[model samples]
Target: MIEEEPRLSAQEMIDRLEPSLSLKRRVRAVAALLAGLAGAVFVSALWWSEPDPLPGRTQLVFALLTVCCLAWAGYGGWLLTRRVPLFATDRVIAAWMGLAASAATTTALAAVAVQRGTGLVPALAVGGLFVAVALVLAVRAHARRRALLRRVRELTGREEK
Candidate 1:
């Protein structure tokens, strides 16, 4: 006769796994904090090193967009540091990051187009490509989130809704 091992309850499994999970969370939080810091530094460097003087209105808009990107990255890192459930919130954060990146790229491309006196057609094409990439990234993030949730539910012996 083949012997089968008894399955542990969710609580029991969690209790046993909590220590490792806590460690993993701490490591992830540290990584996020580092990434945020690096991004801030890079943006600052780029802003500082710009060679030409921009119009007051253009400078303000650029500053605002850069700040928004830095803020979003910092907020995401902070949330990760707080050890919020990854499967629950990480996907949303990832999507937001993707959107932010797309916006920044669009802004940069527009600036380049203006500086180079390029026609609208090339700029529009580039913008379209960026949008397509962003959409793919967002979709992948959501799909990964769903997969993670499903796996968690399976591990806990819960039925999928």
Candidate 2:
């Protein structure tokens, strides 16, 4: 027997759905933007304000760090301006980006410690913590995304019939 389409109101539909872009997400997006911009500015200032000329390698490293910060700021801005709500998929992508960033930063710190022949142990310990946290977040994000996808499929399949 054919059933009539269920008339779900807009608010009712929203109430039933999961993962709206909430206030917390907006605040996080803003925080990311501000932090990235501030970091870039601070790094650039340090890079340019040194009394003595820095080595070529140092200059290149500063430039790369600045660019990375700018990229993060751009990502935050994009998130803020997006018309659609960011869902589990976006979270997964962001978590992975964080993991990569943490890994890169740890590697950089480790290299510098080795180069200077000091503080290697502390650097590794701190970096390891960062990497571990990022890995956990990424894994959780993937799991949540998978669960959301499964739920969506189930809901749509039921609705379509």
Candidate 3:
């Protein structure tokens, strides 16, 4: 025998789910903001430190990474502010873009760290650690967002309706 799914009124759905969605979105936003702040600090360090080999190239890469972080934070914040239903594909697209931006920033940071003449092994190890952590977080966020989109579809009672 097949069981029918319980139907919930729109108000009931909102009441039951809005808080959880809001909390998750807030957490993601905070993470993005913190990442952006970290990038800013990195940029400042590059600017104030004694000249490194190819200082110009290092500075350019650092600046690009910092900008990506800032942009990610701003985009995340805007999504939160707009309350653009998480079911929207735009959320997924933005998340994907943010992931790319984070990876790019991580790569640039590693390059800058290496160019600064730090011991090769230690510099590479630290950079790899940072990249690994960021990758894990990004993957987690992407998975959660995908689950959220699926839930939204289930609730709407439609598959691309």
> Which candidate gets the maximum lDDT versus the true structure?
2
Best prediction by TM-score: 2
lDDT of 3: 0.63
Q: What stretches of model 1 exceed 4 Å from their correct place?
A: 11-32, 45-53, 111-116, 147-161
The root-mean-square deviation over C-alpha atoms between each candidate and the true structure, in angstroms, is 4.8, 5.3, 6.0
Would you list the clashing residue pairs of candidate 3? none
Per-prediction TM-score to the true structure, in the order listed: 0.62, 0.79, 0.56
- Tens digit per residue, CA lDDT, model 3, 1-161: 99999998754663454343467677777777677777777776776674666557766776776677677767656655654445444355555665576567556666666777766676567666666766676677667666765665666665531
Question: Model 1 reaches what TM-score against the true structure?
Answer: 0.62
Regions more than 4 Å wrong, model 2: 1-16, 158-161
Tell me the whole-model lDDT of each prediction, alpha carbons only.
0.65, 0.76, 0.63
lDDT of 2 by residue, 104-143 (tens): 7888889899999989999999999999998999999988
Tens-digit lDDT string for candidate 1 (92-134): 6756676776777677777768878887668868887877887
Evaluated against the true structure, the overall lDDT of model 1 is 0.65
| Shift of residue 128 alpha carbon in model 2, Å | 1.3
Model 1 clash count equals: 0
Winner on TM-score between 1 and 2 is 2
| Preferred candidate (lDDT higher): 1 or 3 | 1
